[model samples]
Target: MKKCRASSRILLIGAGVSGIAAATRLLQNKFGNVQILEAEKRIGGRINTIPFGDNVIDMGAQWCHGEQRNCVYEMVKDLDLLDFTGDFFSGVRMVRSNKEVIPLELGQQLYGIADMSVPKGSNAEAESVGSHLAEHYWQEIESQLPQVDRALATEALECFSRHESSILASDNLFEVSGRLHLEYEKCSGDQLLNWRDKGYARFLRLLMKVCEDEPEELGALEGCVLLGKKVVKIEFIDPDKVRVVCEDGDAFDVDHVICTVSLGVLQEQHERMFSPPLPAEKVNAIRSLQLGTVDKMFLEYEKQPFPDDFVGFFCLWREEDLKQLRCSDFAWLEGISGIHKIKHQPRLLLVWIGGPHGRRVELLSDKRVLEGLQWLFCTFLRFDVPPPQNFFRSKWFANPNFRGSYSYRTTRADELDTGPSDLASPVMGGDGYPRLLFAGEATSQSHFSTVHGATEAGFREADRLIKYYESCKTNR
Candidate 1:
């Protein structure tokens, strides 16, 4: 920490998970003069949880999502932010196309592929879960279930359809095309309990706790980090310095700048703001990286049209009818942790939409989204339900500041592999002096689109700057 603490300066952009994590490491590393600039009033970008009734409904990320062995698990454990074991499939039910709801355990056939340990069978071909869905049929899945229980067949089909429906934003499950790049699908599944039981309003307080001002002579992640400062302009001013102008008319002189803004923010606005303009390759990479959208449609019904014990996942079939409704974006929303607290005459019914289909879904008015949702329910649920007296929804795409749901993805999964290779590399300027350094998910090729990926990328750039200084001293 001491070796690089003096004469070290870092400018971090955005206050998302990755940013905070990177800041923590920087402070610990004793990197001096680190300042983080966030556009929004709060941090924790996508991990947004809102309070409702007796429960807290997650607005941004509802699941501990990804592989259960995800790196976030370690982060939470290290931060001491976990309490429960963090399983994802308790109190689960399926809403079938026949409109009949049934318990999923009575039909384990639908879940076998999801929790199957043999991922190499599905992922070795570089085929995506969408491809897996394409090749596998309902009969094959249902054949694994008990035929004696008629509800088994109904629930099995509905659950499979629901999985496809949840991930691909396409109206049709048949349209979800891609190779599965991620074999480890266990997202830490239980971070912050998928709710703001502490509430989203209080998250800022947590950020303030760990991410506060550092001491006069602190180590990494220390006095280097500051909040409420906004970065307005950034460019390579001299051989060793990258100049940054903030919104409050303050300018910073730093060795490097790590930008981690939303894709929607970059795609729509990058052209005008960047000095000397983005290189053609950078522009192409930016264009090639797709920013998807996912809207959470929340409804508070006056009366529970569904059963009391039924905490169900709704699915549209892979057939033509499901394609027409655009419900095939993502897969399931589980009740294992049961953060929504939908027990004993629950009040909320929520759905997620992602990908290009999610982008279009955001275009519709609340009335239109609700109608589309009802149409989707009718297509899969098989039962008729009345209009909701209270409904709430999120449109991240329309918001210019956000632009889309989160991260970037395309059918070509390898391109989605963003790590150090993908992120821009910092090199010496005209006179062999370190000019500019950039860090973000897009800039990283190995671990892009991930919280840790972004944080590690920031560390990588900081390390690069330190090495550059080491080289200069050795040569002298």
Candidate 2:
């Protein structure tokens, strides 16, 4: 078994968290010939951390979603890499587009209602999260609030929906499947655990076993990964062998291939990239599952405007205001749900944008984005805000490598009865062995759209191969 495993060649496509995790586990299990081919010049797929302003900022993933059962938290908890400062919604200041400051208590109250209104578990009666939330939240507002406050609460609900849209990576909550949304199990403990100055790249370092004091290096997983190796095609050359071709004309024939690319990449390239084509079910699953775009714009000011404790300003645009501004050039600015303070970088503000607008913003000039922000702050916060010294925004949607930020279940997925499980299933070769395996955050059944989910998915695929080899040994 040891000889067989050592002699086998395994190729992992993409150097994201999933690919790295798979490589780490395979190497640990004595799969000596394992190699990772990354599309981009750098590793850490969507977990990109770059130097900005005074300290580092995570352009991709910034938080450890949970503590208990979270692979990222468990990996770095003892190392003191986690920060639990500032509640996500505690310091929320809801200001309407008309510059009316809603009472803190009222804002919190409406937000709480909206939060709880989202259906949980698989038995939800509503088809979509938006439908369930809309019916429930409006009911609560009508019953609980005064006539005057009801209209304001309705606007607040729209703000809450936009925030939810960013979180779910959906254009609108109406498209999100109510039952499938509940399928994602939340880990116990702090949900928005920050990495502070360290950023999410630390997780990649930890996965590679890179020491904190030492200069950041890939360590054991150093030579195993080849960057700028965009996998153009994956074909089963024979029953026991697979061929992976790269954009640079590099090719490798391996015993097995583990595909850890993003669902967005799969959706875009699966048809043309795979030889003999993927199964009908697999294709349907890819089409059904949506990869939503959630983009962030970071602005660094020379002088910080808000207090140290100020978390964010939730922008609630009234229906009438939206109607008037619908035809404006800066209409896409309406997609910005909130402008929040970055925890470690106090001088920086993080703007959350989602859906088609997120993609639209990416194509706009930086000057235009700044101008839009100026209009937004002046309108919502009633301030003539000066332009920031530094501005950085994520282009995940525009980036071919990652078509969007993450995956989310949609009503169509529910209707089609296709999901991560269907996408995660392997393509068995004629030799009765799994020749091509899938692993990513999208492949995670209960933990999709999370770093922990991607980690677990990688481990699952690696374990599957390990188990297959073990069974072969036993049979022998």
lDDT of each: 0.52, 0.87
Candidate 1: worst-modelled 10 consecutive residues by lDDT:
330-339
User: Of the candidates shown, which would achieve the greatest TM-score relative to the real structure?
Assistant: 2
Across 1-476, the per-residue lDDT of candidate 1 in tens digits comes to: 21245456777777765566556655555555667777666565655666554466656654333435455444444544434424433555554445555556654545564334222434534444444553554445445543545444433444455444444333333332242234223344444243224333233334344342432222333444456666667777765577878778888888666676666576777786567676665565566555555677777777666555555554424334444434443222220111122332266666665545566656667787667566655655645667877777677777655676544334443454432344365544665554555665545554455544555565676566566555333211
Off by over 4 Å in 2: 1-3, 86-88, 122-125, 146-148, 471-476
What's each prediction's TM-score? 0.69, 0.96
Per-residue CA lDDT of candidate 2, range 1-476, in tens?
22367778999998999999999998998786999999899999999999997799998888899888888888888988889964655887998889988888888888988887888775463579999999888877767764646667788889899999999999999999986656888898888998878899989998899988888678879889898889999998888889999998999999899999888999999989999799988898999999999999999999777665556799888888888777899989878978888777878888999898999989999999999888888888755568899899999989998899999998998888899999999999875688999999999999999999999999999999898786444221
**For model 2, which pairs clash?**
none
Q: What is the lDDT of residue 292 in candidate 1?
A: 56
After TM-score superposition, the amount by which residue 98's alpha carbon in candidate 1 deviates from its true location, in angstroms, is 4.5
Model 2 / residue 439 / CA error / Å: 0.6
